[model samples]
Target: MEPDAARDIAVTDRAFFHILQLAGFTGGTENLMKLGEMNWPDIRDLDKERLVAVYPIASFEQHGLHLPLLTDTIQLDAMVESMDGKIGDRIVCLPTQWLGYSFHHMRFGGSLTARSQTHIRMLVETVDGLIGAGFDKVLVINGHGGNSADLRVALQELKETHAETRVYGASWWGVAAPALDAIREAGPNGSGHAGETETSMMLTLRPDLVQTDRLHPDGGWPPSVYAGRVEHFRRIDEHSSRGNFGDPTVATADKGQRMLDATVNSLVEIVDDILGERL
Candidate 1:
C-alpha cells in the first residue's frame, strides 16, 4: 500500500536476477520483455483494433509411451513461436489454454480433461473478452482434436452473439495438410494421435522428451458400428492397448522441420487474410 513496499519488491527482483546470473542460470532476460506475453506491462498500451489476437488452445493428455503428456501444448508453443517470430508487429498473442476436454483419453494415466460444457464456455469467454477490447478479429489456433467439436460450436456461438467482430477457429494440421501430407512418413491409417507425424515434430523441437526406446506401431482404439451406419465412441485402452494410435517408428527430425515450416507458412497466409478483412 505504500511506495516503500513497491520499491522492496523491485529490489527483491533485481537481487534474485543477480543471484541467478551469478549461478550461471541461462534464462534470457529478453524473454521477459517479449511484447505479447501477458506478464509484460507493455500489453496495457496495445491498441486492439490495430492487431489480431491469436489464441493457441491445446491440452494436457497422454501421447503414447514415447511422447510427453503435454505434446499438444508443447507443439502449440512451437507453432505460436513460429508465427510470433514473423508477425509480432500485428498480433496480440495470448498465452495458451492448456486444459482441454480429453474424456476419451481419461482412462490413460496423466491425461486431464475439462467438462465439455465448461470447455465451450471458456472459449466463448476468451473470444468475447478479446472482442470487447476492440480487436477486429479473434482467432483460435487449436492443436488438440478432442476440442474440435466444441470449438466449432464455440466459434459459431461467438459469431451469432457478436456479429460485429470477426471470429475464426482453425485446426493447424487441416490448414497445412497439403504440405504435411507430402512429407509424412505414414498414411492416414498409420497416423493419428501420437503417431509418426507428431513424434517427428517433437524429435525436432525437443528430442530429449522422446523416449526412443519405446518406438512401436499402434493404431489406437477403433469405434464401433451402430445401426449399420453410425459409430459409437470407444476408450483408448480398448482401441490402443499402448495408449497410442498410428505408427511412430518412422519419425525423423527432418520431417519435423519440414512439417513445422509448412504450418508456419500456412498460418502466415491465413493470418494475413484475417487482418485484411474489411471489418
Candidate 2:
C-alpha cells in the first residue's frame, strides 16, 4: 500500500476508535473489536475450531435529566467489558450496534431511533453475516429495553441450517434480574426506565457523565398487574414526563458495582451454555 493511503487508513481507524469511545465503546473496546489488539494477519492465524461471536445492541436515547442519552450504549459496552474479562480469548466480540428502536423517546431531545423493521433487519443480517463468516455460535447481548421484542423476533427467525450453529439473544438486565433482587434497593416500579437501577449502573461505569443535581423520581404510569402478563405497548410521553419511570434519587455506585458483577456472572453461565452444545 502507498504511504499516504496507509496513513489515511491508520487515521480512519483511530478516528473510528475515538468515536466508539465517545459513544460508550471505550470500556468494551478491546473485547468488542476483535481479539488481542492484533491486526488482520493475527486474526487470520487463529485456529478455525468452533467460534463464538458476541455482539451488543444498544439505543442512543433519552434517559431522564440525570443520565446521558447514550446510557444504553454505555451500559451494553460495559457488559462486553465484563464478559471479556471472563471469556475474552475464547470468543470474538463483534462491534456493538449503537442505535436502536427508541421511538417513544423521540419526544425527548437527544433520542435517536430506527424503525422496528430496520432494527430487526440489522440484527438478523449481522448474525447471518457472522454465521456466513464461519462462526458456529452467535450471541446478541442487548442493552435497550425497546429492542427486546424485535430482538426476540430476529433470533427466532435466523436462518439456521446447522445444528452446530446457535443464535441467541439476551438483555443483560433481564439475565441478571434474579440476582438483582438480592441487592437492589428500588422497588419494581422504581426501576422502570432511567430509574434507580440503571442510574446506579451508570454511576459505577461512567460517573463523569451522571448529573446528580438533576436526579428525580421517574414513577411512570403504573400498569395494572394483569397487563403485565400480556404484551402491552405504550409511549414515553403518555407514561412519564421526564423520560424516566423510576426513582433515581437512591442510586449508588456501590449498588451499580454489585449489579454489574451480577450481570457478568449471569453472562458467564450463558456463554457456557451457548458454547457447550453437543453436536
Candidate 3:
C-alpha cells in the first residue's frame, strides 16, 4: 500500500472512531452514557469534572381515559433517551425513576406514589450517591406535574446538604416551553393534566399505549377569585371525574413528534450549558 493512501485511511478511521465515542459507542458494543449499563470501573474512571450526571424522574400515574398509567414515565424515558443520543458521552444518565409523588391521582387506581417526604429523601440519597462517586454536577429531569413541588424540595435539600455541588431540576415541558408555545393552539384549558401536550408526547413516544377511542377533553379548576393566584392541593377526582385536565381529543401524532424533537433539542442545549458552566 502506498504511504499517502495508508495515511489518509488512518485519518479517516480516527475521525470515525472519535464520532463513535462521542455517540456513546466506546467499544463498538456499549453505550457509555447510560450509567446503569456501564460497570463500576468504567464509571469510576470517567472524567467527573466534565461529565454531568442525569437523573430522569417521572411517575406511574393516571392520564385520564386516553393515556396509559405510565404516561409520564414513558415520555420522560423517551426524552432522556433522545437526549442521550445527542449528548452521549457528556452525560452519565441514570435509569428513569418511575415512581413519583402522585397522591393526587390515586383516585384513578393505577397511580402509585411515594410520600412527599420519602420522595424527597429518595432524590437526595440518589444524588448524594452520585456526588459520593465523584460526580459534582447533577441534573434532575422531571416528567410528572405532581412531582414538581417535591422535586423543588428535593433540590433544596440536596443543595443544602452538598453545598459545593451544582444541582439543577426542570420539567421537560418547562425546558421546552418556547418550542411548545410556538406550536400550542390550545388555550390555557387545552394543555393541563392528560392534556394536549402530554397526550401528544405520549402519542409520539408510545402510540400503542394511548387509547385513541377514549380521547376527550376533561378539566376545570374551581371557580374562585383566587383560582389562578392560589396554589392549592386538590384530588384529581375532585374536579375532573375522568382523572384528567385539558383536551386530549385534539392531540395528534405529528404534534407529538414535533414536541418530542423540540424537547430533545432543548435538553441538549441545557446539558451543553451545564457542562460549560453557563447555567
TM-score of each: 0.82, 0.84, 0.87
- For candidate 1, write residues 163-238 as lDDT tens digits: 8788888899999999999998678656688888899999999999999999888854335444236666556777
Model 2, global lDDT:
0.74
Clashing pairs in 2: 218-245, 218-246
Q: Which candidate is the best by TM-score?
A: 3
lDDT string for model 2 (63-128, tens) is 988899889888877877778878876677766677788998898888888777766666665565
User: For candidate 2, what is the TM-score?
Assistant: 0.84
lDDT tens string, model 3, 145-232? 8889988887888878789999999888888988998876787778889889988888887888888999888879778879989978
Worst 10 residues of 2 by lDDT: 2-11
TM-score of 3: 0.87
Tell me the spans in candidate 2 whose CA falls farther than 4 Å from its real position.
1-28, 31-45, 48-50, 159-164
Alpha carbon lDDT of residue 38, candidate 1? 46
Give the Cα error of residue 145 in candidate 2, in Å.
0.6
